[model samples]
Target: MPETLLVLLAGLAAGALNAVGGGGTFVALPALVAAGQSPVTANASSTIALVPGAVAGAWVYRRELAPVGPASTKSLTAVSVLGGGLGAALVLALPSESFDAAVPWLLAFATVLFAFGGRLSGALRGTLDRPLAPGPRTVLVMQFVLAVYGGYFGGGVGIMMLAVWSVGLGIDSATGNPMRIAQLAAIYVSATALFLAISDARSSPLVLTTMVAGAVAGGFGGAHLARRLPARLLRAVVLSTAVTMTVLYFLRG
Candidate 1:
């Protein structure tokens, strides 16, 4: 089969998973690398390709987006945008070898978060839901840091954001979901912009076009399906998939 056909199929699968579960890069990145792209190139390509999917997913949850507090949204957006730019720059400037060693560790951490996500959410709810303490300034700081990580290598960013909001900010996962999507959209948008500014323009347009097509289709499907599925079940599916991918990354490493 032709390589382009293979990439397009992979993009479709990744987009579907991204819309529903997150960690689409676990599929897309390896596909790009196997297609003869360098790790750096593949990483950048995957990041760029995934932007439309993120945007599409965010749009599918547009109604929920309005309920997020404006002040928090603004703060998170600013930090995420700045951090994403910095992270994209670092990715472009640094040697790929530096990141190769770290990928497995990062994947493992993401896996642990996914595997224990429900219990962690429950614990946070028990401790933090009473009287609603003031949000932490430190959480805002951490948001920027996590945004940087997302920009540099965005496999399980959604899960990480959920953890930060639930554990650090004392926000419930259900309440924080829309805000997480918005903040991630900001991060990806900023990172995409930075990559366009710094990197060579070879092969990006083709990848972006096909990816966007798949993402829009999958986003609609995922969002529609989400409305039908029980929240607990949906969350479980995402958690399981994320954990499985993280374990695979560790083994591959």
Candidate 2:
């Protein structure tokens, strides 16, 4: 019962995070793992449960959905679906040990990226005299890779997307957020489809159902709340949750 409650709370918080900024996966994945799931299965199940939250949040911003850089909405969505499915397939193909050992490292890497991604991406483009925004093709390629990563483990995909848009395309994070949510939904939809067919995502029905319910509520509520909250406050809440979760995972490792 206690474990069930924890999963519910995690899902609610994760859904809110995804709606407001990004970092829901960081919260959901760890809680599911702690509820006696294997790392791989927890990752898979978390993806499955969070799909509705992503969709709900995306729907709230439907009217505001816009293209990133030179890429059109349809094109970006296509790449996201394809890359996400491919990443999900890779998870089923690889051995669980590979994921277990890599989990800490992955979390740590995501933590660093979320913490300093803006500066890091800026530094990379710092040498360019023109500092041009990424073109359509460039945006597509980057979206595909990030989608693949999202399908694989998610974690900080939202933050990563914001960084890419903020730095590579000179788009403000606020403007890019709606697109981020939409892309995340696309990735999760594809990944969840794969998980439903081939993974143990449905093995734990109670956990799955509760998390989904919580996520739905949180996602809808958070979307409405996002309008009132400042962007910096939203990012700070996400970053704080992300940093704390990453540290705990490393300590466990």
Model 2 over residues 112-168: C-alpha lDDT tens digits? 766676776678677675566778999999999989888887877777787667667
For the record, the alpha-carbon RMSD of candidate 2 to the native fold, in angstroms, is: 2.3
Candidate 1 segments exceeding 4 Å error = 66-71, 117-136, 170-175
Tell me the lDDT of model 1 at 102: 80
Spell out the clash pairs found in candidate 2.
none
Residue pairs clashing, model 1? none
Off by over 4 Å in 2: 99-127
In terms of lDDT, the poorest run of 10 residues in model 2 is 95-104
Q: Number of clashing residue pairs in every model?
A: 0, 0
Lowest lDDT 10-mer window, candidate 1? 65-74
| Full-model lDDT, candidate 2 | 0.82
Which has the greatest TM-score? Answer: 2
Which candidate number has the best lDDT? 2
Computed on alpha carbons, the lDDT of every model, listed in order, comes to: 0.69, 0.82
Measured over all alpha carbons after superposition, the RMSD of each candidate to the real structure, in angstroms, is: 2.9, 2.3
lDDT of 1 by residue, 1-253 (tens): 3666666766776666666656677888887776667777777777777777667767877777632322466677889889888888888877767676687777667657655655676675678675333354566787888888888887777667765554444454445555666676788788888877777525556665665566556655665565565667766766787677777877887
